[model samples]
Target: MGQQAMDTFRSCIPLFQALSDTARQDIILLLAEHDRLTVNEITEFATLSRPAISHHLKILLENRLVEVEQKGLQRYYSLSLDPAVAQLKALIHTVETTCCKESF
Candidate 1:
């Protein structure tokens, strides 16, 4: 792998870590279905506690998997997956082009 591909793969580490948890996956699905939701709203549909939801949200936010919108006193979280998806696609392309080439 070239340096650029290696760097792209490294940059995706946090995104992978954030998505490895079932709690976080549930939150992502909820947001996808609802468009946006507050921590309390997410906790209502999930078995996790409010603090646990917040903790997962923090990780998601840090990884850019989700975005937060401030409305009045309420904060609504929603999916923000374009950038992460692009990075993953790039990594896949790099691997396909560099490592999957067939010899004649």
Candidate 2:
């Protein structure tokens, strides 16, 4: 692989890792549906404890997959259609078109 492709693959690792957990996926789906929600609001639909929810949120926050809104004493989190998702799709395309192309 060229340096550029390798770099893209390397960067995609963290984004994929962040999304690999079921809890995080659930949180993302919930955020997608609601647009924005507080931690308590997210926890209400979750089977995990508040701390676990916070932990999942932290991972999502670090990945830049979710945005935060602070209102008075509350913090609201919302899903972001991030650049990372586009980058990931591009990387997948690069692989499919090159390494795994259909035989002709």
Candidate 3:
């Protein structure tokens, strides 16, 4: 792979790690369905405890997969997938243009 491809993949590692967990995936889907939700609200639909949900939310937030909004004392979480999706798409394009070309 070229340096650009490698760098793109490296940058995406956190996103991949954030998405590797089933709990995080569930949380993402929940947010997608509901548009936005609080930790306690998400906890109601999930089998995990509030703290556990918050932990996953933290990871998701760190990776930029989700965004948070403050409403008084409550915080609402929602998907902020555009940046991550654009990165993944760039990775795909890099692989197609570089790796696949080299293979052929």
Off by over 4 Å in 2: 96-104
Ranking by TM-score: 3, 1, 2
| lDDT (tens digit, per residue) of candidate 2 on 18-90 | 8999999999999989979999999999999999999999989988899888999999999986676897888
- In candidate 1, the residue pairs with backbone N, CA or C atoms under 3 Å apart (3 or more residues apart, or in different chains) clash, namely none
Error of 3 at 56 (Å): 0.3
Note the residue pairs that clash in candidate 2. none
Report the C-alpha lDDT of model 1 over 31-73, residue by residue, as the tens digit: 9998899999999999999998999999999989999999999
Superposed on all Cα atoms, model 1 deviates from the true structure by an RMSD in Å of 1.9
Error of 2 at 88 (Å): 1.1
Considering summed lDDT, which 10 consecutive residues are worst modelled in model 1?
Answer: 95-104
Worst 10 residues of 3 by lDDT: 95-104
TM of each candidate vs. truth? 0.93, 0.88, 0.94
Q: Give the TM-score of candidate 1.
A: 0.93
Using lDDT as the measure, the top candidate is 3
The segments of candidate 1 whose C-alpha lies over 4 angstroms from its true place after superposition are: none
Instruction: Arrange candidates by lDDT, descending.
Output: 3, 1, 2
